[model samples]
Target: MTYVDGFVLPVPEGKIDAYRQMAESAGKIWMEHGALQYKECVLEDAKPEMPEDAPETCKITPFGKLAGTKDGETVIFAFIVYKSREHRDEVNKKVMADPRMQEACDENNMPFDPSRMAYGGFKALVDL
Candidate 1:
């Protein structure tokens, strides 16, 4: 089963192009480091749910709401897939050590708030 890292964050509308550029570079690095797949998606049409329609198990927060997006902000959903958890760890270590990764982080101003980004690792339960 593949292991995955997921991310959700808010990016300023005006910075979408910059964010895409950054993501492209970063995705390339991850792929080179052994990630099977890397994808970044911007929100197209996300809306908050009505009170009555909300799920009882937990808050039915949409991606926009989960990101706490502002008037001119949009949400981004990204993921990286690896062969396994160990492979993911190995790939991440190499990705983080790469000079290009450091250069990108140091030279470019990120388009989104790093503190507001949500991230997690997941073990695939089912794949079809």
Candidate 2:
């Protein structure tokens, strides 16, 4: 099964371009280090509708809400794919050791709030 690193966060509208430039650079590094795929997506539709008949307890939280976006911010969902967990570890190790990656990872200077970002490694349950 494939392994993936998933991320969701809020980026201010004004910084989207800067964030994208950074992501593009980082994506290239990950790809060069053997990541199978890398993607970054921005939120478009802000409103999520729940069916009238749906139970209150059955409601789901939208990405924007979960990301805690403020008035001038939007949500970003990003992921990187790898062949397997061990493969992911190997690729990530190489990526981290890369000089360009180190330069790109100055967290204090990130375009978005690092404290608000959500990240996790996922084991694939279904893929087609």
Instruction: Estimate TM-scores for all models.
Output: 0.88, 0.91
Misplaced by over 4 Å in model 2 are: 50-58
| Top candidate when judged by lDDT against the true structure | 2
| CA lDDT, every model vs. true structure | 0.91, 0.94
Candidate 1's displacement at residue 112, Å, is 1.1
The digit string of per-residue lDDT tens for model 1 on 77-118 reads: 999999999999999999999998988777457788888899
Candidate 1's C-alpha runs over 4 A off are 48-59
lDDT of 1 at 85: 95
Q: How badly does each model clash, as a count of residue pairs?
A: 0, 0
Candidate 2 colliding pairs: none
Cα lDDT tens digits for candidate 2, 1-128? 99999999999999999999999999999999999999999998788888899898987888888999999999999999999999999999999999998988898758998889999999999988
lDDT of 1 at 98: 99
Relative to the true structure, candidate 1 reaches a TM of 0.88
